[model samples]
Every structure is written in C-alpha cells, then in structure tokens.
Target: MSLHSMGLELVETVIYLTNTLICVILAVLVTDAWFRGDHKGSLLYWMIAAWVMFAADVLFASRPLLSPVVARILPTLLVTVGQAILLIGARVNSGQTKVTLVEPIGAVVLHAVLLTVFHFLAPESPLRRVSNGLIWATLAYLSYRGLRQSPPVFWRSYTAPAKAFMAHAIFHLVRTVLVLLPLSSTSEALNTFVAILGDLEVSFFMVALFVGLLLAHLKQRNEQLSSALAEVKTLSGLLPICAWCKKVRDDDGYWQQVDHYFRNHSKIRFSHGMCTDCADDFRKEAEKLQPSDL
Candidate 1:
C-alpha cells in the first residue's frame, strides 16, 4: 500500500479501537450503577441498548470476515434496535412514562423488516442510508422529548444525556442529507470526516452521560439523607415533661399536652383513649354515681 493508504488504514484502526474501548467502559459504568441499586426499568433498558451498540461495533469491525448480506444487515439492525431501546430507556428514566415492551419490540421488528426489504430492493443505496438515518433521528427526537418532559428537579440532571441524543440526531440527519447529495471528491472527504467525528462524539457523550446519571443519583440520595437527619434532630433535643401533669414544655416556655406537643413538633397524631387503670377507675366512679339502679 502507498504511504497515504497506510496512514488512512492506521487511522481507521485507531478509531475503531477507541470506539470499542468507550463502549466497554460505558457498559461497565451502567452495570455498576444497576448493581448499586439504580435498578429502575429505564436503567435496564439503557444497559441493553449500550450492549447492543457494542455488539454492532464489534460486528462492523469484523466485517471483513463476514459475508455481504450478514455484513450489511446485522450491524444496521443492531444500531437501529439499540437506538429505539435507548429512547424507551430515556423516557422511563424521566419518570414521565411507564416501561412498556411494545415500543422497543415493535421498533426492532420494524427496523428489521425495513432493512430486509431495502437490502433486496437496493443494496447499499442512498435510499437505505436515508431510511436508516431517519429511523435513528426519530428515536433520538423521542429520547430528547422524554428528557424535556422530566420534572424540574431532574431536568438539570438529564441535560447532558439530552444533549448527547440531540447531537446524535443532528449528526445522522446531516449524514442522510449528505448521502442524497451528488458524490464528489470533496463530499467523500467530508463524509469520511463526519464518520470520524461521530466516533469521537459518541465516546465523549457516553462519559458525560455516565457522570450526569451518577451525579443525579447522588444529589437525590443526599437530599433524602438531609431530610432524615433534620427529622432526627427535631426529635433528639431535651424534651422537658411535667412530673405530674404529663404536659411537655415547649420552646416558647409554655406547657402543652404531650400529644399536642408531639403533633406540633412532628407528624405524630394522637387518638383519645384511657389506659387500663384509668378505665377501671372511671367505671367504679360511674357505678357509685348510679345509686338509684334498684
């Protein structure tokens, strides 16, 4: 091979290796999160999506060893299905939607059918690329919508992931448009550049997404801990109670019934009832008062 050809090959190898490394790291991070009790349905879906993408990357990198039909269909199917699942995961994570198998399953089936039909009709044509890109863009838009619909407190946490999905969508849409344009030396170079840029973009986005999710979970946990601590502190200080009346002294130096004090200071509510000894004494007093019961 010429020096230029050799250099291009080396660059391609490096890019593929880097992509593989990032996907593996992301998979590990997500798996750890799930084990650490981030076991939401959305998280599970996201993990599956990551693995599917990883598999697609691996298959593509080994494409030279595979037959033509397998080479085209497998990777495309993996990517399309993975994107669909990722969208569902985002929606579920946002707490705005419940997890349903229908969407992800249907998405996978639809992509598979479209890819199969297109392969027969026009193998590796602009039409195929356009269809693939539109499918991905649609899924990305749905994921972005889910993030946008998140509650205010959580929306901040989703910002990075949302941006990542948006960037992916835009990139694919541009690629689709580029495919439709007449091919030239310049356009070919641009397409190659876009492909390289996509790899780098995906790597950065995965790391950012992992960090964002971890921070979001930590923030939520910290808030819960702080609230619990405040409750403990509220009930912990010296509670001065009258030796005889059972009334408690308030912070304002006023005595109030124990039940009233607790009700005001905390969430405790009281039900009026006499103890066994008090109930017996009340019965004796009632019998004494009923003198004319001959």
Candidate 2:
C-alpha cells in the first residue's frame, strides 16, 4: 500500500482497537450489574450483544490477516447479528415477552444481501462503503418502534435509547445517500470528514446505549424495591412470637417485643390499656387487698 493508504489503515485500526477495548470494559460492567441485580431478560441479552459487538470490531480490524471473503462476510454478519440481538432485548425491555424475531432476522438477511450485491456489482464504489448503513438503520428503526411503545418509566428518561439509536441510523443513512451525489463522491475532504464523524458518532452511540441500558435496569430495580417496601408497610399475617415473652421474631430472626415490633413495622401505636378480663382481675385483687391490711 502507498504511504497515505498505510497511514489511513493505521488510523482506522487504532480507532477500532480503542473501540474494542471500550466494548470489553462496558461488557464486563454490564455483566457485573446483571449478577449484582439478579437481572435477566433484556439485561442478559444486552450483555451478550456487547461481547458480540467487540468481537465484530476485532474481526473488522483483523481484516489484513483474514481471507478476503471471510473478512468481508464475517464482520458484517456479526454486526447484523449483534444489532438484531440488541433489538430483541429492547423489545423485552418494552414488556414484549413474545417479541418476534422476524424483523431482526429480516434485517440480517437484508444486510447480507446488500453487502453481497455491492461487493460483486461495485466493489470500489463509495456508496457501497456505507451501504451497510441501510441494514443498521432498519434495525434502529425497529428498536425505536419497540422502545417508544414501552410504558413510561416514572424516573427514567423517555425514549432516550430509542432516540440515540435512531440518530446513528439517520446519520449513516444520510451519509450513504450523500455519497451517491456527484459532489459528495468527488470531494475527498468531505469523505474524510464523514469518516471521522462516523467514528465519533459510533462511539457516542455505544456509550449512550450502555448508559440507557444501565438506567433502564436500575429504574426497574428501584420500582421493585419500592413495591417491596410498600408491601412491608402493610403488615401481613403470621408473625412468629414467643407466647410467654410476647416477642415477635422478624424475618431476620431478631426478636422484638410486641409494642416495639408494631411501632417499627406498622402504623399501629401503643396505648397503656388493659383488656376487660385483665381489668376485672385487677379490680378483684385490689378489692381483696385492703389499705388497712398494708
């Protein structure tokens, strides 16, 4: 390769490597959150997507050592699959437990088809360089649709992930379309700027998605904890008590006196009052005990 081409390749590789490292770190953090929260569903799927994305970047940067077809197909395939999986998780986040895989699978097929056709028909075309954007945009649109339909979370940002994803998709689609124009095709400087902007945009998109996922799960967990607390406030049946000591055994196995337990656990308050039988017994004893006898 010429020196200029070599330098460009080096820059791209460096960017990919940095992105890969970021992806790995984010994946680890997500996995840790998954375990800490005992989370499943979308969080698990998003974690898997993070690893897949980093793997895609690895394959993309290692293109120099890969076979021609393997280099092209594998990286693209992984990208498609990773995004599709992310969409699946997004749907789950929206409470669509039975979300169909049809859209995601169709997107993968479209990505493969687009890449294959462009590789054969116009391998060196500038438009082909950004053509994968079409498939990504499709997935993004699907994700936006899924997430926008989600019930509004009280403390969470509404459709933030949906918007971040859609923004990237729009950027890519617009760039791809612009490349088809004669002015865009001929302007080397503009193309270079687009490439740099694309990298930055991708980084931002990744970070936003990660943050969105984290916030979404945290909101869910907080809501769950709030519900539990509400339930606790409403004291229920079956308190374990020592009959003689009148101490209640809490779930933590700590013993608390009747008045203390009620005060701590419920809205009920203590009153120094005796029952009818106890009052009657006290009166009888009082009458039997004469002040003169003392």
Candidate 3:
C-alpha cells in the first residue's frame, strides 16, 4: 500500500503533536521552578531549548517529505546542544556536588559532532548505528548525573517526578534504537514499538513537568510543618509551683527565667499575677514582721 493508504500518517501526526505539547509543558514547569527558587541557571536554558526543538519537530512532521535535510539536522543539533546544557545546568543547580559540568558537556559535544559528521559521511550505513548508540549513552550519563546530584531530601520528597523524567529519557533512548534499526524487514513490529514509545514519551514528560511544579509547593508545606512542630516542642503552660523560688522548670529543662524562656522558645504569652495562697502567705509574713525587726 502507498504511504498515505497505510494508515501510518495519522499516527505519526498524533505522536508529533503530543510530544510538542509535552515539551511546552516542560518549558513552563522549568520556568516556574526557576521563579520559585527550586532551580536556576543552565538547567532553565536547556529546558527552554528542548521546548524549541519540540516545536521544530512539530513543524517538521507537519510536512515531513517537504522539509529539507537542513530542517531535520538543525533540530537534532539543538537537541544535542540542549542535552549538554541540561547536564551542565544540573551540576550548577546542584551546588557542584554530584555533577561535573565540564566533562559531560565535553562528551556530549564530542559525540554529537561525530554523529553529525557520520550522517554526512555514511548516511546509509553502520556509522549511523554507532551515532545512535552514542546518543543513548549520553542520555544514560545525564540521567545518572541527575539522580546522583539530587539530595536525599529532594529524592524522598520528589521521587515520582524524578522517575517520570527518567522514564521519559528511557523512552527516548528506545525510540532512538528503533530508528537506528533497519525497518524494511520488520515494518509492522517497528511501527508498533514506535507508537508505544511515542505515547510513553509524551505521558512521561507531561506528567513529570506537572509533578515538578507541585514538588516545590510540597517542600514548602513540609517546611511549614517542621516550623510548627518546633514551636510546639518548647511551649510552656501555667503549672502550680512553690512561690519561694520564683522559678519554673517544666518536663524539659530547668528554665532560669520562666517568662523569658517561654517567650524565646514558644508562642505562649504571660501575665504577672500572684495566686490567693501566695498573696495570703505574703500578707501573713508581713504581719508577723515588725517595721524595725532589730
């Protein structure tokens, strides 16, 4: 059957549009995170770049046959560059602890340049295979960096979002392999794999982006809870005690100045007053004592 008659065109169109929308969502999330103080610097740039590449992919797929080779190659280049930027940005945002910016960027640039050259040198051969392998390898490296650099608190707090991004990366890598394999012999199998991968990729990215947005808010809630708990820990209450000492020690520590300690440690307010017993004791003590005891 002819290409249009084979029913693949509609599927491809849908996949392209879905991925484009996912990328847009990711862009908005990255921007929001930067504004909310969760992320900064190169990561934001790379996300924006990825969004642009997704747009280009949408435009290219709209008229795939009519699009020029440069049109295709340019977006691939942007993807390569953006991936490197993201690697660097991860290091920067992570406080230079877990990710190393220089080495990863250098590796991505080297591999991408080699792949571009291979595309021209051996368009219809295994050199392209090697190039595709490099792409997956680079993605694996970046994923590793992202996982390693994220703090334990960040991990426990945002595990689902992290998994979403990792799953999306895996889907992209699988799709890359699918594209690299010779498709003439196993067209049906390959087409099914492509559709599945496309759906996974779109869902993974879109969900991850939204989850990331909510993650910052979740962290804020956690902070507020912690603050409130601390406030409750050292609060004091009115407890009957000996009036001779003029000091109060609760279940915790020996409080030197009850009013000062409570004011310092908790939200309790105090008013100075003497109880009936203390007032009567003071009055009787005064009556027994003469004006000049000597």
Q: How do the residues 67-146 of candidate 2 rate in per-residue lDDT, one tens digit apiece?
A: 87788787878988989998998898788758899989988887788778777787767855666777788787788777
lDDT of each: 0.74, 0.79, 0.59
- Could you tell me which 10 consecutive residues in candidate 1 have the lowest summed lDDT? 151-160
RMSD in angstroms, all models?
4.5, 11.2, 9.8
Q: Give per-model TM-scores.
A: 0.75, 0.74, 0.60
Runs in model 2 deviating more than 4 A are 154-159, 236-294
Give the alpha carbon lDDT tens digit for every residue of 141-229 in model 3: 56445645654433344443445445555666666667667872367666565555555454465556345535644564588789888
lDDT for position 251 in model 2? 81
Q: Show model 3 residue runs off by greater than 4 Å.
A: 4-10, 36-50, 59-67, 97-99, 126-130, 157-159, 168-192, 195-203, 209-217, 228-251, 255-294
Clashes of each: 0, 0, 0
Winning candidate number (TM-score)? 1
lDDT of model 3 at residue 6? 59
Write one digit per residue (lDDT tens) for candidate 1, span 1-294: 778656765776676677777788788877777778747656687778778878877876776688988887998798877788787777787775455667667777888888888888877456776777788888887777776665443445445567667777887888777777777224657666655665566566666655555565666678878988888888997999999999999989999999988888777899998899999998888888855873
